[model samples]
Target: MIEPQPTRRRPAADVQHAVERMRELARALPARDGIAVFNRVYLTVTEEVVRRSADGLFRDPLASAELSARFAERYLSAVEVAAGGHRPPACWRPLFQLRRHPGVRPLQFALAGINAHIGHDLALSVVDTCTARGCEPAEVEGDFERVGQVLTALEERIREDLMPGPDLLDIADPLTHLLGAWSLERARDAAWAAARVLWRLRDLPEVYGEFIEGVDSSVGMVGRCLLTPLG
Candidate 1:
C-alpha cells in the first residue's frame, strides 16, 4: 500500500484563499458563537486588506498579502486544532475556552480574539514572512505597518459595532476598564519588538523556543483576562 501524504491548508498560503476559509467559518458557525463573532471580525479585516491591496494602497502589495496570509494561518491553524479535538496554542486557548460563556460580552470575545492574534500570531507571522521571502524583518516593516494601520482603522468600527453604548456599559464597568487596558497600537508595537527578537534568535533553537513559549503563555494570560465575564 502507498503511504498517504499529510494534508495541508493550501488556502492558508494565499490571501484570497484564506479569506474564503474565514467565510466558510462565518457561514457554518452560529452568529452568536464566540468563535463566529471573532471570525466575522477577522473576515472583514481580511477583506479590507484585499480591497486596499487591489487599490494599489500598499507600497508592496505582494509582500503585504504574503505577510497577511501567513499571519492568518496561525489563527486558522488554531481553529483546525480545536476542531480536531486538540488544544490550540496557549495564545489561542483562552478564547476557545470561554467562547460561549453567557456573561462574556461580544466585545470581550472580539477583543480577546484580537489580543491572541495580534499578540502572538503576528510576531511569528513576521518571522514566517522573512523566512519565506528571503528578507529581514526590517525589509518588510513597511508592509507590517500598513497592515497594522488597517487593523487600527477597523478597530474603532469594531468597537462601535460590538461595544454597548454608554446607556448599556460605562467607564466604571470592568469590561470598559479591560478594554482600556489593552490597545491595538501598543500590541502592534510589542509584536514588532517580539518579531525582531524572534528573527535574531532564530539561529539559537533553544533560546528561541523558550522566548516563544514565554510569549505564548503571557499573551494567553492576557487573552483569558480579556474574556473574563463582566457580571
Candidate 2:
C-alpha cells in the first residue's frame, strides 16, 4: 500500500529561511538522488542570490528577495502536495514522479526541475511578486533576469559536468536529442513573455486563471517528455 504524504506548510517569508529549507532538504537526501541533485542545483542558485542581494547587486533588493522567496515557495509547495499524496502542478509532475527512477539520470532530474520552475513557476512568481509589491512586472524584470542569468550559468556547468562522456554523442543518442530540444534560453524567453501576458491579464481574474492553467499544463507536458527514462 502507498504511504500517506505529509503536507508541510509554506516556507517562511524570509529568504534566509527559504534558503535554509532548501539546504536542509538537500542535506537530508542522498547526494546522487534525483530530487537531491535538483535541490542542490537550486540551493546553489539561492545562495548566490542571497549573496548578491546582500552585496546590493539588485536594483530592487526587496523585490528581488520577495520574488526569490515566492518562487522557491511555489516549488516547495509542489513538493508538499506530492508529499501529501496529492498531485502537484503539471510542470512539477515529472520531477516528483521520476525522481527515484534509476534509469532517469541526475542530469535529467536537474534539467527537468529547471524546466518546470522556469517554464511555469517563474512566470507565476513574477506576477505574484508584482501583486505583493504593488508594482509592475517591468519593475521586477531586472531581478527576474538576474535569477535567470544565475540559472543559465549553472545550466552550462550542469551540462558540462553531468552530460554523458563523448562516446554518447552519436547522432542516434537519445540523450543528445532530448537535451538539444530544450534550451534554457528559449525557456527563459517564453517565461518572460508569459509573465508579461499574465500581468496584462491581471484585471481579468478569470482569463488570468485560465492562462495560468494552460502554461502549467503545457510546461508539465514538456517536463514529462524530458523525464522519459532512457533504457
Superposed model 2: Cα runs more than 4 Å off: 1-13, 165-171
- Cα lDDT tens digits, model 2, 1-231, are 999988733322477888888888877888877778888888888888788778877888878888888888898888789889999998998888888898888778888999999999989988988887799888887777877777777777777677768445678878888888999999989999999999999999999999999999999999899888986
RMSD of 2: 6.4
After superposition, the stretches of candidate 1 with alpha carbons farther than 4 Å from their true spots are 1-13, 166-168
Error of 2 at 70 (Å): 0.4
In candidate 1, how many Å is residue 55 off? 0.9
Over 20-99, each residue of candidate 1 has an lDDT whose tens digit, in order, gives 89999999988878899999999999999888888887887777888888888889999999999999989899889888
Q: Model 1 clash pairs?
A: none
lDDT of 1: 0.88
The alpha-carbon lDDT assigned to residue 120 of candidate 2 equals 97
Cα lDDT for residue 194, model 1? Answer: 98
